[model samples]
Target: MTCIADANVLFSLLVEGHVAHEVARGWWDEQPDGAVGTCLLTRLAVLRLLTNRVAMNGTPVTPTEALGAWGRLGNDPRSVHVEAEPAIHESRFISLVSGRESTPNLWTDAWLAALAMSLDYEITTFDRGFKSFRGLRLRLLSMADK
Candidate 1:
């Protein structure tokens, strides 16, 4: 099965000190060639969060460092970078958002869900928020609430 790495899992994989680091790392390492990946949205989110001063608990990473991490991830032979088909992506995103009662914060989450749905990739995430969107195939990572 194809797997899509969500921002949470991507972030955990990048930051060795993260609570989910080991599990994320292990899962990442075990994926067969071409079986795991992440979309541009997830990549952007990882870069933004990793380099943000406030979001990263004041320990902001340098842009260069974040880019290097992204490069390394992309260079992995087993990884695929999924791009969104704009028409399908937008339509699915809107359907997911409008079909449910959701706060404005869920817009990106909806996009992620839509992207995965369109590509038929099962999402890997630690966030339970993804559960709100229907018809998503999720490989929810086992992690303690932090």
Candidate 2:
């Protein structure tokens, strides 16, 4: 089975280290070979986080070091896929999630959720906010409520 990952999950693995990282890794390992997938937004978010860290520290994180973690995870023998699409239809997803109500923040989360829905993929996230959407399968990190 293919799973779509959220930026938080990827960031936790890249920056925070362990816990969620291991959990996500385990989940990915359990999926059918070559079934793990991430969207372009997730990658951009990770890069932004790394860049912000560099800016705050007054030093850049080398591309090698910044991508080391992702490379390791992505290179796993298990099936993994990364979506390269840059944009997704926001209004279509917003309408599906909130009906006529105005939705807040039309970013990666909505796009990821919409893409997952369109492709019949499960979401791996710790964000409780995702619970509000209907028809999306979620595998929340175990520590999410703690």
Candidate 3:
């Protein structure tokens, strides 16, 4: 089965070194070659994070290293494909968050959810916001779940 990974999952694998990392790693290990996919937003989100780090905290990750990481992720034989459609289904995301009072702005989660729906791939994330998005199959990973 193919899975669309969220940015948080990728971030954990790349920087946080949290349980999500192990979960993603294990999921990758189990997938057949080229069976793991992600949305283009995921790639943009990672780049944004790296950019923010450099701009704000002055964390010194060279552009070459960042590009190498991105390339490695894309070249993985287990990666099914990376969907880059931004105009996919997104209205449902706006509607879902419009009524929530306590929910923080999670635009990336919305995009990821919509992409998972469009691609018919289960979502792999650690964020609980995904739990509220019905019809999009999700696999939320925790330390205990891992």
TM-score of each: 0.89, 0.70, 0.77
**For residues 78-127, what per-residue lDDT tens digits would candidate 3 score against the true structure?**
76556464455666566656766654646667767777777778898777
lDDT of 1 by residue, 86-143 (tens): 5687889889888577676588888888888888888889878888778999988876
Order of the predicted models by lDDT, top scorer first = 1, 3, 2
Whole-model lDDT for model 3 versus the true structure? 0.70
The TM-score of predicted model 3 comes to: 0.77
RMSD of each: 2.2, 4.2, 3.3
Top model number, lDDT = 1
Weakest 10 consecutive residues of candidate 3 by summed lDDT: 51-60
Q: Which 10 consecutive positions of candidate 1 have the poorest summed lDDT?
A: 81-90
Top candidate (TM-score)? 1
Reference-based lDDT, residue 146, model 2: 33
RMSD of 2: 4.2
